[model samples]
Target: MDIFLIILAFVTLLIALVGSIVPALPGVPLAYLSLWLGRWSGYTPFSDTFMWIMAGVTLAVFLADYFLPPLIVKKLGGSKAATWGSILGMILGMIFTPIGMLLGMLLGAFLGEIMYAKRSGYMALKAAMGTFLGFLLGTGLKLLLCFYVLYELVSTWWATGFGGF
Candidate 1:
């Protein structure tokens, strides 16, 4: 039974960690939950400090990941329409293909710009680029957070004697 609990905790952590980057999955909270389970298991490998830091990273990344894209698009001179359109495009992208979604963001922004400035392909392109950059940065940040949390988990476990290292 104890062994089963440990296994369950580890599996949950794995799923949460994976979810953190795959847009289709809820990442931060899942990662957080995994850590919580580890601590609750009373056999966590990490010191309290490590777990807290990992949680903090998860929270930060979660906030940034959800907000950066729109902010980036807006900063690039995208109107509200462009920003919203890019957001929709990104959501759609998850259902389609990553590349397709990225392209959709650019096209969506372009279309948004066109609604206001038809024939200004150059300006629309700039807006699309902003959306893309934002999306890229957000993803990178999320991935980094995910890795940080995973590392903490492993380190905590290792320090606790899981690997005999």
Candidate 2:
């Protein structure tokens, strides 16, 4: 049963890693769940205080991930329309995977700035670039956190003799 649980935790962590990029999955939450599962499975290396701190970080990162791109668009002189369009594009882009999502965001921001906001081409392009940069940053942050959590889990397991698995 311990071995089974350890395997399950590892699988959950792997899924969490993938979720960090997929947009639909709550990657940070899933990764946190893995830690919880590990704790329940007799891996008590992580204290409650540590878990709570991680939970807070996860929530902050999750919320920031969604808002960062739009905020960047706005910061780059994009209008509300551009911001909304970028967010909508990102959500819709989930259907097409990575490339589609990236392109959708860029196109959406550009069109929104040009057509809806009546911004000049150069300004629209700048906003789109900002959106793209924000997306990359958000993705990077989430991936980093996910990997950190995974590392913590694995290191703890290793330190504890693989959790007896």
Candidate 3:
């Protein structure tokens, strides 16, 4: 049981780390899962309170992950269409390279806006730029969150032994 729990915790942390940059995985949630698994295995120096604290941080990161991109784009004069297009482009972008994904999102949003209102191609470009900026912001925040989770996991584990967190 201890070994199983230990393996689970490690794997969860690993995936969560990847989740930060990927945007497709549940990074924060996976961090929380690691904490939960640690508890179930056996509580340690970290305690439930500490777990909750980590959870709070994760929640903040989650908020940043979801909102900053769209918010940034909107601030840059992007409309709802551009925002939605950015998201769609991102999803499709994952199939291609990261650079491709970024460009695809920007172009997709811009083109989408232009298609909707042919006279606003310039404005559409602005909106697309906003969307790309948002994506970068979100990615940065997510990476930060992922690293924090890793630090917490490593420290907690160190303090508690292999099964300790």
Candidate 4:
């Protein structure tokens, strides 16, 4: 039974890692669930306080992922239309994944700037670049948090020896 629970926890963690990139999955929450399951399974390496702290961190990162791109677009002199386009593009881009998402955001911002904001080609390109940078920064932060959760899960599993090797 302990081994089964351990395997389940690991599976959840793996899903969380994938969720970090997939956008549709609630990555941090899933990671937290895995940790909670481990705790329920009698793994004692992570204290309740530690879990609470990680939960808070996860929530913050999740929320930040949504706002960062739009905030960055505005700061870089992008109009409201450009910001909305980036967001819509991001959502639609999820269908094609990675490359599609990247192109979608850049294209969205460029078109928004040209069609709605009436910006020159050079300015539109600059705004698009800013949107791209924001996207990268947000993704990097999420990956870091996901990796940290993965590390914690593995380390606790190793320390507890709950799987019986």
Q: What would the per-residue lDDT of candidate 4 be over residues 56-142, giving only the tens digit for each residue? A: 998888888888877888888888778767767777887897888888888888888999999999888888988988888877877
Instruction: Find the number of clashing residue pairs for candidate 1.
Output: 2
Question: Clashing residue pairs in candidate 4, if any?
Answer: none
Q: Which is the winner by TM-score between candidate 3 and candidate 4?
A: 4
Name the Cα RMSD for model 4.
1.9
Tens-place lDDT per residue, model 2, 57-153, is 9898988988887788778887877776777787788788888888888888888889988999999999989888988988898899888988888
Residue 74 C-alpha lDDT in model 1: 76
Tens-digit lDDT track of model 1 for 96-156: 7777777777777778777855537777888888878987898787667656666766676
| Superposed model 1: Cα runs more than 4 Å off | 22-24, 116-119, 163-165
**Model 3: what TM-score?**
0.83
Instruction: TM-score each candidate.
Output: 0.79, 0.88, 0.83, 0.87
**How accurate locally is residue 15 in candidate 1, as Cα lDDT from 0 to 100?**
77
How well does candidate 4 match the true structure in TM-score terms? 0.87
Query: What local lDDT does model 3 show for residue 145?
Result: 68
Q: Of 3 and 4, which scores higher on lDDT?
A: 4
Report how far residue 72 has shifted in candidate 2, in Å: 1.7
The candidate, 2 or 4, that scores higher on lDDT is: 2
lDDT (0 to 1) per candidate: 0.71, 0.83, 0.75, 0.80
Question: When superposed on Cα atoms, how far off is each prediction in RMSD?
Answer: 3.0, 1.8, 2.6, 1.9
Task: For model 1, name the residue pairs that clash.
Answer: 45-156, 46-156
